[model samples]
Target: MNVFVSEVRQLIDRHLPHYVQSLQAEPRLKEAMCYSLEAGGKRVRPLLLMAVLEAYGKPISIGLEAACAIEMVHTYSLIHDDLPAMDDDDYRRGQLTNHKMYDEATAILAGDALLTHSFGLIADAETTEMTAEIKVALISIFSKAIGAPGMVGGQLADMLAEKKSLTVDELAHIHRRKTGDLLTFSIVAGAYIAGVNKEDRLCLEQFGQELGLVFQIKDDILDVESDSETLGKPVGSDETNYKSTYPGLLGLDGAKKMLSYHHEQAKGYLHKLGLSDTILGEIADYLVERLH
Candidate 1:
């Protein structure tokens, strides 16, 4: 856990409760929903969104709702991904997964609610000081990133690929959609809100996609090497399902080398942007170093 991620987790903890509490539905069900939201996962995407905003000399407060919206989408994906029809996991973030803690139907509803509610959160964001065009751009970017051509399509490909052999390029494509798309939005949303020019925003998009590919490779490596207790989910599940992964296709040593290559590429982009912020560097380092 890096210090910056720790700080971001604290920010989420402080802000998310008020937002959830205000949702005010069936108190028990809503409480369960909040439980899943506040269960202390790594708030990685949200932190990246905020950090990118900060890197552009913008206040994090300007993107707080957007940041939290990203988390909501991430959380919803995890909950559904853990469903019996999906990954069928029993644990997450060192706790019972939503389906295991609550019932499957409740978990389904929770995920659905989170996804829809995320849009509402973004819509209700206090952008009074921002121009209308910037706000509209933020909304468009977030929607497209999480919609049909992005995360949803990626998830479908991932499901279809289970127990199947895929070329390195195919695997990369699936990962880009499944994981990279939302991450791209994370960077783009921040930059769009901060009025970054189109060319600069494109650079950030490239950075996000490259960084996302590295992140997924590292995640696959962790699935091979990390313990179930440490991972809070079944380890070696990729092997169990006969799925292709970096380690499966490239071998552990080869995968490590490939990860190094992606990391260098991403670092090169960040350097071109003249970023001195150690947070972005640390994120890159964390993505590569966490597999062990």
Candidate 2:
């Protein structure tokens, strides 16, 4: 593993434990919040942001607050997603999901708290060296990404499509907004804080979008081909929910082909960025190779 990856992982692990403890609540509610927040997963999104910063020669200190904020937003989404009203999943990361482990109201509140707390985390980060304009822009980008026009909108679209056949375009739109927006934000956020120029930022944004799409498509394919033990959630849940995905719409072989094409496209964009970094190459490879 890359040293940066290990360090970033440790940073997240260390901060998350204490961060969860700061969730002021009644004892039982506190436990419920801690349960899901502590659940293990790949931490791909936040790590991607941190890696982008490292690749651009920014100190981890500059990106630490943004990295944790990304995770907080991600965890909040997962909590709400597993609720009965959303994906209705009973398990996540190979354990009982928030709603399954706690009452529905507690799960809902926990998700809400995490989402609302993310902004405070960002605002409180010591950003003395960062210009006020840049910090405000970053906050705006993240806020919009998590709001109705972004993840929440995509989720609503997904819910509307459940049990009903959807066109390939529809599936792409949903996942692009649901997953791609935040993933794009990761790259853009890192690049912005690193002071990359506008043209390079545009290229990186495109790269991140393609990467995020590939990530989601591969996930759908794995849902069809991998067992629950590897996936950390029920395999075929998309099919179980009758939700549309790349695999559900295009067949396994077709989805794999799409993934390969997008993976290569993402690499092509990365090459255009002119940055020399082992982490970027390793990340691209890992995105294609990861089983979960």
Candidate 3:
């Protein structure tokens, strides 16, 4: 699993700079885009996509383009999320956010470039070895996952829910769209590329959903327990923003319990897919245990 993670991280690191450099027409925009893309991260979304491909006996090359595409979308979301009108965060991954390092307009334009360029990358003939039909399907999935009914809707709900009391179900609804949809797409996109059996694909989708919940719950717990230096962002920002969180609704102990429950559920889905002892299994564990 360590080797797999290392390989994917290296693959992304080597290629991401080239992608940013392609935007030479607007040097400042390219700089802002590259700044966040180059910033160190776990690259969990792309890793999950490639890992699913590897596990299904598909060549990792087949999914690398899609992985990059998804990472672009994820990074774009972070840039916008940190804007003054949004999360208003000053730092990300221990460095000034794009909006902070550059200007707000530059940051917004950089994000827009990343989001649009991702689709172009996916559609480019040189990007992947998949068929035209497969590429189209992947693009459709990618668009919908990040579009109104998915990540965008969730973000809108999250923003609207601020300073308002929410039921546990309502909070879950917000996250299921906001975070879960994209994570689910990451795994399922690989499955589609690999042409995995429908049953296994469904299992992976379930695992992604469970893993997303575990991720958000762990994040909330970390915000309470971790320091800013360790987290690379401010702690208690959720409180400051009056956003709904698992910990806030469930209490620290209840949130921890929920995390454990989802961890088990994610593992169970992997077991159902006959991947209980694979790197995907280890990833499930790692997601729950990771502090940042």
The number of the candidate with the highest TM-score is 3
Measured by TM-score, how close is model 1 to the native structure?
Answer: 0.94
Writing each residue's lDDT as its tens digit, candidate 3 over 40-151 gives 9789999888888888777677787788889889999999988999888888888999999999999999999999999987887364457788889888988888999899
Poorly placed runs, candidate 1 (over 4 Å): 1-3, 128-130, 276-278
- The residue ranges of model 3 lying beyond 4 angstroms of the native Cα positions read 125-129
Which candidate do you rate higher for lDDT, 2 or 3?
A: 3
Clashes of each: 0, 0, 0
| Deviation of model 2 at 153, angstroms | 0.4
Looking at model 2, which ten-residue stretch has the lowest summed lDDT? 273-282
Ranking by lDDT: 3, 1, 2
Q: Compare candidates 1 and 3 on lDDT and give the better one.
A: 3
Alpha-carbon TM-score of each model against the true structure: 0.94, 0.95, 0.96
Top candidate, metric lDDT: 3
lDDT of 3 at 274: 87
Query: How well does model 3 score by local distance difference test?
Result: 0.87
RMSD of 1: 1.8
31-100 per-residue lDDT for model 2 (tens digits): 7766876798577777787777777877767877777888888888999988997788888888999988
